[model samples]
Target: MSKVYILMGVSGVGKTTLGMMLAEELSVPFYDADNFHSASNKEKMQNGIPLTDLDREGWLGKMSSLIPEWQSSNGGVLACSALKEKYRNQLAGGIDKDLEWIFLFEDFSIIADRISKRKLHFFNPDLLKSQYDTLEPPDYGIHIKVENSPEESLKEILQKLNMPEFGIIGLGVMGKSLALNMAGKNFLVSVYNRREGELEENIAQNFVDKYSDKYQLQGFDDLKNFVFSLKSPKKILLMIKAGDPIDEIIEELIPFLKTGDLILDGGNSHFKDTERRLEKLSELGIHFLGVGISGGEDGALNGPSIMPGGSKEGYNRVKDLLGSIAAKDRLERPCCNYIGPGSSGHYVKMVHNGIEYGEMQLIAEFYYFMRYFQDRSPEAISKVFTEWNLKQISFLLEITADILLKKENNQYLLDKVLDIAGQKGTGGWTTVAALEVGVSLDTITASVFARNISAFKKHKNQVRELYKLKNKADLEITDDELFKSYRSASVINHSIGFELLRIASVEYGWNLNFSEIARIWTNGCIIRSSFMEKLSGIYDSTKSSHLLLYPDIAEKLNEDQEIFTRIIPAILSQGCPMQVCSSALNYFLSFTRENTPANLIQAQRDYFGAHTYERIDKPRGEYFHSNWKPE
Candidate 1:
């Protein structure tokens, strides 16, 4: 965190005075241009003549090249009359690449008089006119124009120019909205996006038109141009599409961007895609961020969930800015976190959607049961669903319940709805990643597969050629019993669903913090709820373990296990898919109670071609790999 105040102005302006004061306050090295000047320039200046642009070119180059070491190691202020834009531009190149420039301005007459009062110096009072003539005020830097007091200008620059921890890159819908949210709090914001259209769009949308020049939108034709648009010590984000375009964008930008520059893929990317890209990019010393953004178009245009990962160094560049922009969850924590290195952010999002699949299925199952088994009016079913949602449930579930209950144009929309549901690519992605990561996604995958099965209109038609599938018309259940069964089954589904996510975290190096993940889900993410808030709190004391081991949740399952058992048969009778849910909960309860799982036994057989078992007296002792058991 080296602060080097590079003072630029005509020779008579208060740059030297400010540089001296700034150095003393900061307690660091300070260099004056007068000391560094060549004898030729000094002789010319002493003879009441100003130095030309060409005369000062070498000096400017030297200063520009020197400051990088100072910026890297020990930094103070450099007092130089960076008279022209070209000279200042030279200072912006090479190792001085990330240099920040400051310009001190005073009226020509005001400065000439000041120079006249000065003691013996090479710069004569007569040369002030030519210095003013040479000066074309710098546009892309700090301009202090109050009085000629160096300390006053230094104070103002320190107050204003020292921006917040990080900045935003792109200024599209998501990026601009994020920037606006940050800049509203006076955070340092640097935005880059496509050059052709939407410059006005970003300005109008971000409300940055008020302070138009401050919140600059550096228009770029391509990714390389975009990278150049960012401030040095860059942290650029990719708020563009995923797939080939993301690669194209990063490939072009990588050469220009430094090792620490971040490229956030805030798209609905496949987790495996994230993993592969991050690995490739890391070799180039470039950081790749696969961030998962949920909450739809409005969410993109407003606040959204932000899951970031890949290159901890890159995230360290911009976490605070990202946090400020993300929507807050139940714990009042932002819906933003370092999801893990590489594709872990998108991986988490994939699992997030996987759980979403399960959650949606549960809702759909409840709807189907209400319609088919209970034979209740849509209104009656909606009432039941809404009432159930009044307890500590997710916003996704609660909203679904609300939507189910709502009368659309004075009619129950649920009654007129088609049975089929549409799914995007996330279902397939969740399954694919689970397979690769060795996570058991029975609940989430079953939910996704159920939707896939639903899409089989042709196959369903072909079912007429085979044995006719019998409808569950003979099944009967009481409302009290049915409601209890549905509720218990839903919990079982959720328990199993979270287990899949837990397994994914363990298998991959993605360190999914349950409390933080739950907090992020509260608002912008899909599985947001009071349940998550409570879940977040529970993980505080028991974070090392999985979500299934949360004491409160485990206790809830124990309390309701009896109810779940009684309701299981009724759920099956009602034609609901309670099988997977049942298996999940059973496995969880038994697995938590002991370590000798049947699946583990099967896994051992698969691995080593041997059957092994634990003795009753010695639970964790050597496995019994001996002869057959006596009947």
Candidate 2:
């Protein structure tokens, strides 16, 4: 059904002017009820005779008929002197449509002065008193004083119609920061979190108390009331845990949501789960958007890279708001966009975490090399890391330097922390995806395995005591050479990651933009770096299948390959584990090689299991079985 916006008031109150302006602004047809008045009624009003209720009957009937006609198309805006309750009832009661009444009210003296200045209008200035006496102000419709400009009035109308632009359905750290971020952008945000006890209640209350004075924020503990607080075509974002918890919350929210509402899941959810939810919610005319929000607590509070995917219509509705709250690049473009259909956003975020794992492992290996091989103390290592950061700027490197500099009770804090690292499945997901796509993500896979090995505390200790294993400390390398080797390995690790993304984009049909991904990761993400900006430039200039194959990157690798070659074996000889660095070197070498020994393995398979093998002299895909054992 179409909508009807009726600008109603006493004559000379600027109804026609405001209605025309509103119609143009809203892109709707404008209609003036006076144009539909009968000749006799116009004559009476022209001769200073007040229009009786009977005189308006024909005009009102014509308006009633014209309303539905305009509504049948794209809706309309009408300047109607619906000064009486009965007239408004007749205009609204005769149509099955959305009717929004806007009363432009002003003091009688102000309107009378404007009426006195009218030159060609039919209605006389003396009739203003009769119109006011007959007026019955509407209690339900929006009322705006005639004291504001047209633009201000239009803004107020849109705001009243779309208040509480976003409804956040969780109050955890991510949710709270997102709510405050929206509020900071001048968006009215309604926040809700399930309160099982006093702790959750206190958290909600504290957030409200802290930011309510500075922003337009409201906190709700009741789910039904929270849903009620939002405007029509509601946008509700859930920042709770993934999986079953998301399902439970959706089930609870479904009762309160109407058709055309949108529910966005902002957790690190599995893509398959997002696909299922999108399918299920769409049946009820509700849209589901799977959003991937990166950057930890600080990024949440400031600005984070937002990846939103799912329904295109849903994205259109929320794009401006998302952009308003997202981090901006050096050129100030928002780091948010509609990624693709279904769970593509989450898939990108998963790969992002996998690359994060590889980068973190590479830094750890460098730290270990400096500490054991070069016999550097924590402070010494921190100074070197800080110096390296000036030339190679990255979020991980900056934080690593900070961690190395931290001290507690006269001891290095990082040295006292446990060696075992905990993971939350994204790295493993990346590995699984690599296997599925037939791509090699060796560096990241090694990083995941290294974390697993670190968990074998008791077994490792027993083996160490049995063998009297010790790390050699005599090996040394200049800081410049070590930095070059680390940089080379980091490039190779990223090369494998981008390759996985390239293959997955083809397999998933997402048409993922590698340059856009790099641009977004330049800031407000865990893997943010000056290197990402350079990577974006590389992808923009050349569409290479692999980063290592790109001309600029390949040239850099050629210059640094010798340093990587020298460091890998030297670190191994010192008994210091360098799984990620070693894997990166091996991957680079294997990728660049023109030939490999896998041909012998193919022949072995053919001989032992009768598996087929292709001959070097024959065309591809024509297979033959070897009979070496029989011979």
Which predicted model would earn the best TM-score? 2
Worst 10 residues of 1 by lDDT: 216-225
lDDT digits (tens) for residues 172-213 of candidate 1 = 566666665666655565555544566444443244455566
lDDT of each: 0.67, 0.85
Which one is best on lDDT? 2
The CA lDDT at 545 in model 1 is 62
Candidate 2 regions exceeding 4 Å error are 1-162, 541-544
TM-score of model 2 vs. true structure = 0.77
Native-to-model Cα distance after best TM-score fit, residue 580 in candidate 1, in Å: 5.6
C-alpha-based local distance difference test score of model 2: 0.85
